[model samples]
Target: MEPAANVLDLNQLRRSCSSCALYELCLPAGIGVDDLDRLDATVKDKRALDRGDMLYREGDPFEALYVVRSGALKTFVQNEAGDVQILGFHLPGEILGFDALATNLHVSQAEALERSSICELPYAKLQQVTSEVPALHRQLMRVISREVVEEHRHLVMMGRQQAQEQLASFLRSLADRYQRLHRDGSALNLPMSRYDIANYLGLVVETVSRLFSRMEEMGVLQVNRKSVRILRPELLAALCRSDAAPRRKDAG
Candidate 1:
């Protein structure tokens, strides 16, 4: 067993992590260099997973809070019928296992969508660190708040949007997230397959394929297999706006 106090090196991790787009968000709102060093000292372990690897299964005992160091993860719950309902896609800088904080059992399984890395902060040590460091508490609060907002957005998407609108919204949101990760927002290299995307958007795989074809035909985007280039982002945005009026109504 690894020693409880085996912490990652602060300066080395920071230096390696400086180029990542998530660095600013991963640290607290007002964290300085010295504070970051302290926070880094608390990270107990780092692990990497390949695409299609499972990080944790549902019902596993939750022991640590995980922060995505790079790549993406899909978190989902399995129903009694064994159908999977994707909860969310976690990008780098995002934290996982919070839902289990109160109950101690993981509510969903976290699966890697691509080659990914994560930093594990042991829950006991994390609690101690938060007690000692005000910034860490603030950072955790911010993470929780963001999750709430994202959940609300997902609810709205599922409740209100049509299938096409939902698909467009998902793609646009993905582009924005990709941009935040310092990747090309306009050009997307989809890590998830059409089936995965279909499941996530609550649509059939055929519907997802059709929507992609339609978007391409409308000159809104160019698609080839898993790669997409947004040709007309404004038009794509319009397609995503289910509440917006038709062109004639807007003209009037």
Candidate 2:
């Protein structure tokens, strides 16, 4: 196994990440050089989490907003049946814990699916900074808006799309997000396991595996365990846009 990383390494990474893909999307427009320095100073970087580690639990006191600097995170809520229904997967350059911003209490749990580094900006300091920095405020609002829009889209994906479409859309969405982080979007290193993907996609683990195999056979993707390569982006996009024919139960 690889040795675990340290907090110092995380801090160094953050400091050196001046050209990160999220810099433009995360920071407010027209932020002055001095303001950027202040914003950087307020962030507290944390070491990457091992697989299956809980970043925070539901009902935990909300203290800071977390930004995923690298790797993936899964947020989910438990149903009455004690099964976890995953809300979504957060990629690098995305912010987590927005639901807690207004209520000051977490409504769901965030867990690292792999070795994930994060930077925490304390709520108190963030509020103060936003008051002084108009750009920061604007950026925060944009982030919240993006979350709302994504949630709305997810609702449609779950309610209107068939199982195959849902699965295709999920893969395409993941690829897009990965690309945003300057990673190879077409080649996905899935941090979440088959069971987690199943829970998130509202399907069984076997069904998830079957879908992967079928997509591979159809030349839509190349799958090997947790890794996936999109062999035909256009076909996958077509399926995501509700154009692909539904696969038979046995076919997928």
Candidate 3:
């Protein structure tokens, strides 16, 4: 048998990138073991956070990218009037810190929505490694492009006037993201509060609450506080595409 020290090292290797639950989603497709090893070396320790913790504040210098290993975070910016506008809700395996790439300073603040763990990849070291691995460079571009696309999609989502449609689309989007993680699409646990959802959707908190109650009454979903179970996904899909105005009760 191998020495105890050697056996410990072997166990560490087994838990590296190749063995990560999100390896396929977070890393470049078809990347080899050697490349994976090199990339894994740049990752710092997993940082733990509790609810309401600030991962990074706006204007902080960006030194690394963060991947949500578990739980969730939300990024937001505040206006001069102190009104907060949530930029995005980030889930597991998704990368953050791209907002700083252009200016070298974070434009938004990132906060943990619940207990979470994040993998930090120092950008300078990451760049050096990616330069030696062409596939890694391409993957970086793909992640950046994805961030741009999501920003555009969010802008469009906020432009719609119907509260019901907006709420439905938001739920559907979360369900789709959950499905991507190989979880149940019909079940969702919202870490962000209803007020946060309202802010993100460009509606008032009262309207958001009313919309959820209406959807539950309509048999579209069952809401038990933060947990929601989608019952009529088809109806939600229709709400997203429909041009009809919301009922009088939802006019809050």
Q: Whose lDDT is greatest here?
A: 3
lDDT for 234 in candidate 2 is 90
Off by over 4 Å in 3: 1-15, 244-252
| Per-candidate alpha-carbon RMSD to the true structure | 5.9, 5.5, 2.8
Per residue, candidate 3 scores C-alpha lDDT tens digits across 92-161 of: 9899999999899999999999999898999999999999999989988898898898899888888876
Candidate 2 per-residue C-alpha lDDT over 42-70 given as tens digits, one digit per residue, 9 for 90 to 100: 78765578878998988899999988887
lDDT of each: 0.80, 0.81, 0.88
Measured on C-alpha atoms, candidate 1 has an lDDT of 0.80
In TM-score terms, candidate 1 sits at 0.86
Model 2 TM-score relative to the real fold:
0.88
Better by TM-score, candidate 2 or 1: 2
The sequence of per-residue lDDT tens digits that candidate 1 reaches over residues 112-167 is 99999888888887888787778878878988998988889888887754677877
Ranking by lDDT: 3, 2, 1
Best by TM-score: 3
Off by over 4 Å in 1: 1-11, 14-21, 244-252
